[model samples]
Target chain A: MNGWLLAATVELGGAGAAALWGTATGPLPRRVMAQNLATSAVCPALLLLAQGYGRPSYVDLALLMALLGPVGTLVFARLLADELLDDRPRAWTLTWAAAGLSAAVVVAVCVATGPSRAMVKLLLIGALLIGGNVIASRALAGGFRGVRGA
Target chain B: MADAVIVVALLLVAASATAAVAQREPARQALVLSVLGVVLAVLFTVLQAPDVGLSQLAVGSALTPLLIMLSVRKVRRQARAKDRAR
Candidate 1:
């Protein structure tokens, strides 16, 4: 787990540097690359933290991350699409709000629960969170052609 | 024996991950990630998680990289179209 953690930390550091460079250059590909690297680095770090401290409850971090990863990528893609399709702030704003709220809720739940039953609950809750998102996305897509398929 | 395999696997995984990001070609990047997945799967096997190893092999090593490659191809096609339009 430490090994995984260390690797993730190193990758995160690399990604951070890349992000800085990307920001400076303002290249869309560079920005996408940085975001992808950062998100990928996160999952392993969460896994490591969960294992290292014996706080299996940190699995919630992983669970929340599973939800966030694709969403973050899509959000970035959506933002990119805005630049190409039409410059619009509304899509980005909504994605940011949704991502932020879910992340906050996951962190709050993780902090509130103790290690044992908390871990199990975290897994269950995290599954439900992701499950709900998938269902909602599917429903929205089916309901409206404007929603755009995920 | 197991410990040795793990150390080697870890090294390979690290190398693969680095190569994935470092490579200029998208196809090479995908290939490197696939290699990393395979190395990690072996490490998982050594750790006695055959289930995980199987999933890694199925999803990470095989499915994911394939999908990534396809996405890359699509992106490349789009870029070519954009260039042509310009």
Candidate 2:
């Protein structure tokens, strides 16, 4: 369809493949890391889809992804903490790359949207996506001392 | 073509679902299942059903895995308790 949709397709496909592979056959830590990256990847793609479909309402899905994707990863971090005690899963490169992509997508979408309430919403989703991503990554790497299991 | 995304989404769902089934451990299965949920949500979106996709994101990304992991943890704790009692 449109370029935005096309970009969404490529991003979803590429990131989805890497995530599936990483999670399907690896150590538990790697699997969790893959899950976090997948969330980051999927959120931006959802935003792109919303822009491509010309449906501002669809943006809610991306917002939800940005909000909840990290929640899922954090769930694993908390529940699997004892299991992951010895090995900390850290993927700053992939995490930062996904954050940058999301930022790019948000900026592009805002420029296309011009000065409007929708642009502000897009900015909010971007912040949530990147912020949640970092938090989730930090959780997986055992960054928060309070988060360690008893 | 417009169909490429649809095709990609479909293939991801199929592949991830199969992988979910293939996983040997419940924890690992839960992990794969989470990925499947996200894939399914994207598939729904690509098919022009963001409503379904939205709900799927809510349930699939976090809720389902949380439920599964909690259940697994409970069962494991019960088993350990029984072992200690013996």
Candidate 3:
């Protein structure tokens, strides 16, 4: 409808398509990496959708996603450690790219929102999104060797 | 015009769902399913149902994959143990 919604649509469409393609037809490590990236991709789109719809409450979805997306990736990282131990998937470029994209989106939204509690919430989501993403990617790369089996 | 967002979300959901089903390996299928979950959450949000979207994000993103992967690991472990016992 508006610019924000249009942006959200484009982002969701592009990233979702890429994620689907990557996850659907890839080796184990690549698929895991794609799954991790999906969280980063969709979280920003959700933020944009919240702004587009003019409903701050919708941001809760982004927050939950920021929190949970990596957990899912970690789940795979831990359980599939046997399969991935050989390849040790490392996509630092893609990880940082998604992190940067999320940061940029959050900052833009915060600037539009100005100083307020909502801005703080936006910052929190952004922090969680980037931090969780990096940690998940690291785990996938076998950074925490001790956490492999459970 | 404005409906483009909805159209895109719908298409994503359809594609990801099909991908999830078409995958052969359970572990790989779980990976696709997790992506499907995120895409579905985005679709829900676009459709103006954030409440459902929130729950979907919680369940679909992490929980489903965690459960599936865990079960796969358990089954594999048990099968290996059976082989060792024989």
Candidate 4:
């Protein structure tokens, strides 16, 4: 309806399509990476949706997603450790790109929110989104030794 | 139009749900299912039901995959143990 909602729609359609495709048809490592990207991709759109709808409560959804998305990926990284051991899947380019998108969306949302507690919350979600994304990517890539053979 | 966002979200949910069902392997299906969960939550949110979306995200994103993967790991380990015993 509005610009913010439209951006959210585009973000959801593009990134969501890529995530679905990547998860549906791919090697295990790539599939796991796509799963991780799903969280990062959706969190930003949730923020935009909250902004578009003018309901700050919806931000809670994005906040919860920022926390849990990587946890899900870590579960896969740990459980599928042996299967992933040999290849050690890596997708740094996609990881960074998603991080960049999260940053842009967060910054845009923050400015739109101005200097308020809500802005701080948005900043927190952005940090979690980017940080969790990198950490999840590393885990998927076998960056943590303990995770393997455990 | 606002309806476009809803339509996109609905289409995504349908595609991911289909993908989840189409995956033959448990691990692969679990991965697609997780994606499906995220997509569904987005749809719920777009439809102005954040409450459902919130619960959906909580269960879909991490919990369902965790349960499925744990069972898969146990089943695989059991089969490997049986093979070694023989």
Evaluated on the second chain alone, the candidates' TM-scores are: 0.84, 0.98, 0.98, 0.98
Which 10 consecutive positions of candidate 1 chain A have the poorest summed lDDT?
Answer: A86-95
**Over 4 Å off in model 2, which ranges?**
A148-150
TM-score (0 to 1) for chain A, all models?
0.46, 0.97, 0.98, 0.97
Sorted by DockQ, highest first, which candidate order results? Answer: 4, 3, 2, 1
> What is the C-alpha lDDT profile of model 3 across A32-55, one tens digit per residue?
998899999989999998999999
Task: Report i-RMS for every model.
Answer: 14.0, 0.8, 0.7, 0.6
As for candidate 2, its clashing pairs are none
Give DockQ for candidates 1 onward, in order.
Answer: 0.03, 0.88, 0.93, 0.94
- Residue-level lDDT of model 4, residues B23-81, one tens digit each, is 89999999999999888998999888999999999999999999999999999989999
Tell me, per candidate, how large a share of the native contacts it keeps.
0.00, 0.86, 1.00, 0.99
Model 4 alpha-carbon drift over 4 Å, by segment:
A147-149
| lDDT digits (tens) for residues A1-150 of candidate 1 | 445344434433443334333322344444444333333333433444344445554455455445544454444344344332432212233333334444544454456455666656665645544444443333322322375543
- Give the TM-scores of the predictions, in the order they appear: 0.36, 0.97, 0.98, 0.98
Instruction: Give residue A16's error in model 3 in angstroms.
Output: 1.1
Best by DockQ: 4
Model 3: DockQ vs. true structure: 0.93
Root-mean-square deviation of candidate 3: 0.9
User: Can you write out model 2's per-residue Cα lDDT over A1-150, one digit (the tens) per residue?
Assistant: 899999999998898899999999889999999988988888888888888989989999889988999999999999999899899999999899989999999999999999999999999999999999999999999899774545
